[model samples]
Target: MQITFWGAARTVTGSCFLLEHEGHKFLVDCGMFQGNKALKQRNYSDFPFNPAEIDFVLLTHAHIDHSGLLPKLCKHGFKGNIWATEGTVDLCSVMLPDSAHIQESEVEQKNRRLLRAGQPTIEPIYTMEDAAKTLTLFKGIKYHQLVKPAENIEVVFYDAGHILGSSVIQIKYTEAGHEQIVVFSGDLGRYEHYILHDPDNIEKADYLVMESTYGIRFHEEEKSKEDLAKIINDTFKRGGNVIIPAFAVDRCQDIIMHLNSLVEAGLMKQGSIYVDSPLSVKATDIFCDHPEYFDEDTKALAEKYGTCPLKTKNIIFSETTEDSIALNKVKSGAIIISASGMADAGRIKHHLRHNLWRPESTVLFVGYQAEGTLGRRLVNGEKIVRIHGEEIDVKAQIVALDGYSAHGDQTEMLKWLSNIKEKPQNIFLVHGEESAMGQFAEIISQKTGIATLIPEMGESYKLNDLAHFVEKQKLAIDESGDMMELYLDINQQISQMMRAKEWQKLFDIKEFLHKIS
Candidate 1:
């Protein structure tokens, strides 16, 4: 048995992992690379392994970073079933097509500039047809139900409490006449979250693959209803709009619930609230359909309101491009929530472009801003920024309330790990930056006295050979002169050249290498 870290190693996005047992190969996430251009460019690269060779994909959730690349996988010849929770399946039904639309739209916009310059146009990573086809292959499984995706493999999903229907996947399989169990913590959520249930507990596993997104940080104390009211009331008094960049799925709904409470309590005056992303509007409706997934507090709020917790008298669902554009005309007393929580893509950018230069306007960020993302730039206090080719000054009030983050904090993550009665033989950390991974690895070692490994991108590990495992070595390369080693070296160099945009030098190197060969 072997496992490969294909993505989400030393980074926060693109969460794919490959597991092989008994001649069967399957994936854990198959997510897309997000944030910086170098990472996003990976979306256009070929799969490290042939997608058609993959037996199945065990999806953890419907978050774009976790499931955005499914259509791309399908477009690249993957034709296997994708097993996920029923809620995840339903969310993907809307989210995948929305992601495809964004891809197409971004490519189209880029092509227009290329056309004017007489340059070659580029295609989207995947089209809506590919997304539609990918959806047809979904096989919904209920939480906690054990199912077999391949021979000698049994899989079960536990509530991760991150986003709606997110899961911690457990896999039990036998290899070389011995049984082994692997548990993957797929973005564990905070305890006592507003809408979702707490993360489920597990007691045993031979090996564990965990996420450390917040390993070195702790979230701020939860704000009271009054705090939200204060921000809104203050912004309104300044004759400015509160533009919030929230995720379309859960965060948007959570913010709406808070706003509804504030209004009902008379803490803030009733005002117009525009949901600018069409995807967010659709996701809000989906959130309404899954009342069973809500916690007692959220359910009670819904009952008290006698309607969906996300709905209010003053709320407006902006479903059309014109309607979204019209929102930029509003000067004050409007709470505008848009998708792409990071504010890197979607209508959020348009709203920011128009409002960011106004001193009275407020831009509230309610999610994690990845390194090198536009959201991070604004959050980090960049004085000036360019949006849609227009340079804009950063004059608006920027605030980040990380209490609204879906991912749990460092203490919460440690508590989740400490719950397992028997510590695993090895804990492999992924889905985090280098600094966080290093810090968390040390903390886990000191607290649990268990060994931990921080795998790098494209790193592989042989699970059956415990004693021979060498951390940070390329997989299956036993000698310095091996063909596989040379191939990996060449691939690494080519990737570096591509990232550096050294097209001519890259071609010359390739030609020289071919001649030498």
Candidate 2:
């Protein structure tokens, strides 16, 4: 048996781990590649392994970066069951179809631009039919339920507390009288979050895969709530709207909970909080549907409300296109929360187009902004950006609430890692940037005496071999009984170009690479 870093080796998105044993293949988190133009283009690339041969998928969460590719997987002919927590499956029901719509819409938009430019039209990765088909493959299992998906393999799900129904997948496989337990930390959620339960800690694992998105940083918890209220109050006082680009999953509901608290405490004014994304509106309902997944405080609050704790008295749900369009007309004394937390797509783009140019308005970010995303550009203080193909000057205050991140920070991750009764032989860090992973690997080594391993993209390490790793110099293909060499030269060329571009200081490098790649 061996494990390969199929995706999310040194980057923060696109998490997949390929495990092969006894001529059988399985995967954990066959996620979509997100972030930069290069990374997003990888979504259009062929699968590293034949989709038909894969036995099963162990899903960790419903975040697009982690679960977005299921439709494409199904589209490509994978008919295996996808095991996930109940929350994840529920979220995916709406999310996957929404993703398909985005894919079709984006491709259509691109095709229109290409048509005028006399360029070739492109195709979407998958369609609504594909997403609908993918939904059928999902098998919802309760957390902590011992699942025997296949012979010699046992799977269990633990709450990661990252989002509603997010899980840390634990897999135990016995082969040749030897048993190995491997745990995949999908995405660790913060402790004492207002809505979700804390991440569940495991006692032990033979080999571990962990996420390190916040490995090098700690959240600034002090005064964030106060700061949030202050920001909203100040924006409303200035006769402007508070525009928040948030993910529709847990972040949207969490922000609503905060808004509800603010309203209940009389911290916020009697202004409207518009949830402009239908997906968010649906997700909020889903949250209410699964109050069993809520934390103690949230559960109590939910029971008290008898509705959804995610709902606020002053909040409005924008369900229709007309409702969403009407929100753009609200100039002041309103808080508009939209989806595509990165502000790269969905109704958030329209909200930003209208509000980002207004000096009185504020665009607040409450989640991690991946590199090369519009949200990152805004947070990095880009003065002007193009939305809907028009350049808009950014005069609004761009605020990032440091404490609102769903992921746990370094200290929390360490605390969770320390709970293991016995230290694992090796620790493999994935789902983080290269620098963060480096610092975290060093920290783990120094603090716990465990040899931390950082696997590069497409790299593989045999389960029995601790000291050696096989780099993907031969090809970029994942294991499918035998390694295949198809995109080696092209991928190598692209990798070289990316490295060279990184080493050089070029202001137009992003646009240049995007155009060519």
Candidate 3:
């Protein structure tokens, strides 16, 4: 068996990994690239692998950075099945199309600019039509379901506790008459996530691929609710609207839970707070539906409070376009939470467009914002910003609270790795920028006496007998070409995948982007 790191190799966004075993090809994730505009432009580039050649895809969760590129994969040529948990599939139904719309709109705007400048025009990375086709290939698998991934590969999933249906996937593949277990800890969640349950512990594995997003930094604030309460109270006393651009899935619910706790403790005024996303409201319902997935503390909180977090009197769910528009009319001190955490698009943009120029408003950031995103630009103290074709001055105060992050911090990451009694032969750290990966690698090596490899994009490593043959091929292709080929192949494979008979086993695509595999 051989594996190659594609996207999210040296950087955090655009997560994808290729694995080959017994002549079968598969991908762990097909996320979108983010950050600088030059880097995000890679999304418009062709796939490096044959999309149709990838027989299956194991998804981790529905975060845009992890699952945003499925439609492009389908548009290129992939027609295989995408396996994910049921909740992930459901979330994709809402997220993927929204992502597609963003791409379409963005491309159109870019082309218009080029047209005026008399430059060559470009098409959208993928259209809504392509996104629609991609949805036809989804196949839902419940957590802990063990099944064969390929000819001689068995796989199982454990709750990652990152998002509603996020998972940590374990693959047992056979090569050279030996069975090896490879575990992919897809964006491991914290042991004390606010919305979802704690991450599950794995017994053992021959090899492990882990994320190092916060591997270098500690979450400074342990009292997340206390800090949140303080921020809200300070803003409210100044008679300012607390504007938040949050991811509509787990983060939105998590914030609500924290706010509920603050209200219950009488630390925060029970003022009107609006969750203004239909998708978020639906996702909250799913969170309610899956009580079995909750951790002990969350379950007990639900039992003791007699209501889920969002059901409180101060909270309002805005589900209609009219309702969202009407929210602008309320000028008093209100907490308005909207979607697209990065503030790139969605109702959050509209909210920011209206409220950002006001001195009596506070924009609170509770998630990681890619470098080019509006949220990042604002947090970095940009005085002027463009939103929906209007230039607006950022007079509102900006507050960033990283404690609300779902991913485990450096301390939590060490704790998780410390649980392993026996270190594996090799540890490849993926899904983080160079600084983060480098710091974590050094830290892990020092603590565990295990050297970690931070693989570059397009770099490959052989695990069994076929290692020599693949390494020789790796030598034949330039590193840059290999990376391009990986994406090009993905494009070609997914485009032709729809014609295959076993497509159902991989996915039907009707549901959405599923896993973080």
Candidate 4:
């Protein structure tokens, strides 16, 4: 029995893990690679393991970095059930298809460019039909439900609180008449954050596989609301618009909720908050449908302010291209939220192109901006940028609000691990950059006195203890002792025959050698 770290071992994207026991193999989170060209190129690489041989997939959430490659897995002959929470399934129902659309659209545009450059056309990683087919294999499991997916493997999903239906998967596997538990913390969320439940505490685990996305930093979560309100009010006072390039799923909705809170508190000035992505529109509907997952504060607020506390009177959803284009015509007092969060693609690019040249506009980043992305470039104070083949001046105010990060920071994560009643024998860290992983490993080891491993991409480790292999070797040695006498007799007979130069007894010598050789 072993586990392999396929992705998210050294970098903070493409979270995939493969576990094998006896002959059965399963995967947890087959995700797409995102970041620089080198990282994004990994999405096109062949999977190390055979898709057909995989028994099932245990999805952690609906984040594209965690579940985006399901369509590609299905396209490559994976015909297994995909287990997830109800909310995750519903969210993926929209997100996966949207991801496929992006893949096709991007590939088509690339092919056009390739044609002009006299290069070969390339196929998309997957298609809309492929994503549809992948959806058919989904099986939803409620939070805290225990399930036996295989002969020797049992699993339970607990709320991770990072996003809707995200989970910390605890798996119990029986080997050598002994049972051991492995907990995979898919992605942890902020404690007592708006709209979602706190991450559930896991009492015990023999081995823990945790994410370390925010290992080296602390988020400004405590003062996020104050910071947001101040940024909006300041921008409004400057006669500028506040533009937020956010992830459509959680980040966009998070900003929406904050905007609603600001409006209710009368902290933000008069401005129209526009969620300008169709994906965000669909995701918001999904969020509205799953109020059961909301925290007490959110539920009470909803009751006090109608069905959804996320939608304020000034909030507007621009789900159509026409509506998105119309937003460019507005010069000020408009807070436009769009995706992709990294500003590497999507309608957010157009918004940036239009507003970035304006001195009165303010761009607020609410999530992590990876290196080599437009968002990072803007945050790093690039004076000029080219969007859609046109150079544009970067005169807008660029700001990053760290409080909106979904991943819990170092302090919160340490507190989360301290919740385990008994320390795990070994803690394997993944889903973070190398430097962060190193720092986190040291902290975990120093605090808990438990050994921590930072696995590299494509590294595999045996789950069976050293004693088991040692015992097996001893048994094999004892059994081999029975052959020692026969070998001695055969060696003596062969030596005597050879000394006598017994050519006529060659068959007898050969028979003796064959008996024990």
Q: Write the per-residue lDDT of candidate 3 for residues 72-145, one digit (tens) a residue.
A: 88987898888888888888887888788888887777666656655566777788888788778888888889
Q: How close is each model in CA RMSD to the real structure?
A: 7.0, 5.9, 11.6, 17.9
Q: Which stretches of candidate 1 lie over 4 Å from their true place?
A: 465-517
Better by lDDT, candidate 3 or 2: 2
Stretches of candidate 4 off by over 4 Å are 221-227, 466-517
The 0-to-1 C-alpha lDDT of every candidate, in the order given, reads 0.87, 0.86, 0.80, 0.86
Error of 2 at 122 (Å): 1.9
Flag regions of model 3 displaced more than 4 Å. 224-226, 304-308, 465-517
- The sequence of per-residue lDDT tens digits that candidate 4 reaches over residues 380-449 is 9999987986789999999988888889999888988999887688888998978778988998899889
TM-score of 2: 0.91
Give me the runs in candidate 2 sitting further than 4 Å from their true place: 222-224, 465-468, 471-517
Tens digit of lDDT per residue, candidate 2, span 186-267? Answer: 9999888878888897977878899999999999873555667899999999999999999999889888988888888888
What lDDT is obtained when candidate 2 is compared to the true structure?
0.86
User: Which of 1 and 3 is the better model by lDDT?
Assistant: 1
C-alpha RMSD in Å of predicted model 2 compared with the true structure: 5.9
- Candidate 1: how many backbone clashes? 0
Looking at model 3, report the run of 10 residues with the lowest lDDT sum.
472-481
Q: What TM-score does each of the candidates earn?
A: 0.90, 0.91, 0.87, 0.89
